[model samples]
Target: MSPIYFSLVTILLSIITITHATTITVVNNCDYTVWAAADPGGGRQLNKGNTWNLNPAPGTKMARIWGRTGCNFDGNGNGNCQTGGCGKLVCNPGNWGTIPKTLFEYTLAQPNNPTDTIDISLIEGFNIPISFSPTSNSGALGGNCRTIRCTADINGQCPQNWRVPGGCKSPCTSQGIGTCGANGDSRFYKQRCPDAYSYPNDDPTSTFSCPSGTNYRLTFCP
Candidate 1:
C-alpha cells in the first residue's frame, strides 16, 4: 500500500489501456463495391459480401471508419472516390477523408472509463446507409446492447441542395458546421435515422457504448 508502489501500478494500467486492441469487422452489404476506409486503420476494397477487419489501438480517440462509394483506385492503390475519399486507397492515420459522407466513429477505453464509446455520425454527411453494433450480446456497460443505424434511403430523399454524386450532404456540410441547426434539413435526416447523428451537435441521442474488449461489425447498405 506504499505511495510509490501505487503510482507504479497505476502507470502499468495506463500502459495496458493504451496498448490494447479492439476488433471491428467492416463489411460491405451493398450490391456494389465499397472502398472501406479508416483513419488509424487504412483502407481496403470490399466487394459485395466482402469484409475487412480492423484492430484499432486502445485509448484511441477520433478514430473513424467510412465507406467510399464509386471509387476507382488503380493497381497501385491510388485514386479518388465519388464520396468519402481520402485521396488514396490507403488513408494516412487520422485522415478524415473528403466527407459529405456518413461515418462510424469510436473511441476505445481510456483511463477515466474502461469502455468503448461509438456512434454513427452523419454530421459530415451521408453517402451510404450504415449499421454499427457490438458483436457481443453480453450487454453494454450499462444497458442492453443495441445496434445504431442510418439505413434510411436518405440519398433518394435528399434535398436538392444536399444532393451530391453518391451521398447526401448534411446541413453542416452544406452550410458551415457552426451554423448547422437541429431543424430544417437536419430534421429530415433525424426523422429517418433517429439513432444516427444528423447534425454537428448530436451526442445526447446518438452516442452509444459497450463494455471494454467487445468487438463490432460495421455494415454498409445494411
Candidate 2:
C-alpha cells in the first residue's frame, strides 16, 4: 500500500481503539442482597410474620433475596436490642407466601470503580401491635404506635450524633441491644441503633412502644 494510505489506516485504528477504551468500565454489573428491619423506636410491634422492605443501593443490581425470620426487640431498657435472640430477618418461604421472598431485581450501569456510593429507599408494611412496653421512668406520652398504619418516610433518620451505648452495635442481643465490641463509636452507634435493634427485637424500652396497625421505614447501611 502507499505510504499515505498506510498512515491513514494507522490513524483510524488508533481512534477506534481509544473510543473503545473510553467506553470500557471497571466496575462489573453485579447483584446484591439487602435485608430490611424496623426503624428505631419502631418495627418492634410488627408480627413475627411481617414483610420488610429490602431496599437496594441506587445504581446497583439486586440479584437474590435471603434472610432469617421473626421480630425481636426489647419493650424496656435503653431502647437497645440487648437480647441475642428474639426475632430475625432471614430468607423464608412461609413469610413470603407464594410471591417468593424476592423483593425486586434490576440491571446495573457500568461503573468507574470510583469510591462513590449509591443510596436507595424501601417501604415496608407492619401490623403495629398494641401497647408497647413502656419505660419505668415517669413521663406522660401518647401515640398509637400500635395499630397497623401504613409506612412513613425515613429521610434523615440516621443522624450524625446517633450512638448505640456501650461497645455493642448491630446484631443486637436478645434484649435488643448488642455489644459494639471493644473499639466502637458510641455516637454513630446510637443513631444507627434503631435499624439495628429493629431486626432482632420488636421492643426496646417500655416508653418506646409500637402500637398495633402502624408501619415504619428506615435507612440502613449497605
Candidate 3:
C-alpha cells in the first residue's frame, strides 16, 4: 500500500475511536422540579416533564447520577436542597450529591472489556423513585441488559428510626453502622428492591452490563 493511503486510513480509524463516547439522557417525570446532577456534566434544574442530555468522554469509567429535590438556589448557584444536595448549580471540583438518594451508577468501557456496567443503587437509601433503561436502538450486549428500577415509596414506609427530612435513611446509616453484610437492615432493602445494591457487598445480580456503544435513558420518579 502507498504511504499516503496508509496515513489516510490511520486518520479515519482515529476519528472512529474518538467518536465512540456514550450518551445518557435524564428525564424528570415528577410533578415538581428536580435538579439532575452528575459528576462529569455538573447539574441542571429540570422543571416538571423536562429532560437533560449528557455525553461523557469515552475514557470516563465511573460516574453517578441522582436528583435533588426542594432546592432553592439563587443567581449565584448557591443554595440548599432537601435531598441529594450538591450545594451548587454546577457540582464540580469535589462536590458530590448527599446521601439518602437513589443513584444511577455507571462504569463505561474499560481497557479489556467492550461492555459497560450500569445499575440502580439503593444502598444509600431512597428518596425518589428511579429507573434505568437502554434506548430503543441501543444494541445490548448481554441478556442482563434490561431495565432496573426502585419504584417503591421508601420514604413513606421508612422505619421511624430511619426517617429523614426528605429521604429514607438506610437502617445501617441510621444506626451508624457500616457494611451490613446479610444483616436485617440490608435484608429490608433487598426485599424492597431486589435488583438494586442493598449494601456494599451486594453484587452478582445487582450489577448489569450492556454493549459499549449503547445509549441509556434514566428516569426520575418513574
Top candidate when judged by lDDT against the true structure:
1
Query: Which candidate gets the maximum TM-score versus the true structure?
Result: 3
As for TM-score, the candidate ahead, 1 or 3, is: 3
Residue 44 of candidate 1: its Cα lDDT? 91
Model 3 TM-score, 2 decimals = 0.90
Candidate 1 residue-wise lDDT, 92-185, digit = tens: 8867799778888889878898778888888888999999878874465566357889998999999897888988888887588877878877
Mark the regions of model 3 whose C-alpha exceeds 4 Å error after superposition. Answer: 1-11, 136-139, 174-178
lDDT for each candidate structure? 0.85, 0.24, 0.83
How does model 1 score by TM-score? 0.88
The parts of candidate 2 lying over 4 Å away from their true place are 1-90, 93-141, 144-188, 191-207, 215-222
Q: Pairs clashing in candidate 3?
A: none
**TM-score to true structure, per model:** 0.88, 0.20, 0.90
Indicate whether candidate 2 or candidate 3 has the larger lDDT: 3
Give the CA lDDT, 0 to 100, for residue 212 in model 3: 73
The full ranking of all candidates by TM-score, starting with the best, is 3, 1, 2
Tens-place lDDT digits, model 3, residues 1-222: 999999999999888775566789999999989999998889999998999998987867678898999899999999889999988877884576788888888988788987788888887778889888888434455568878888887888788877889898876565554645668877777888888988876779799888776788899988
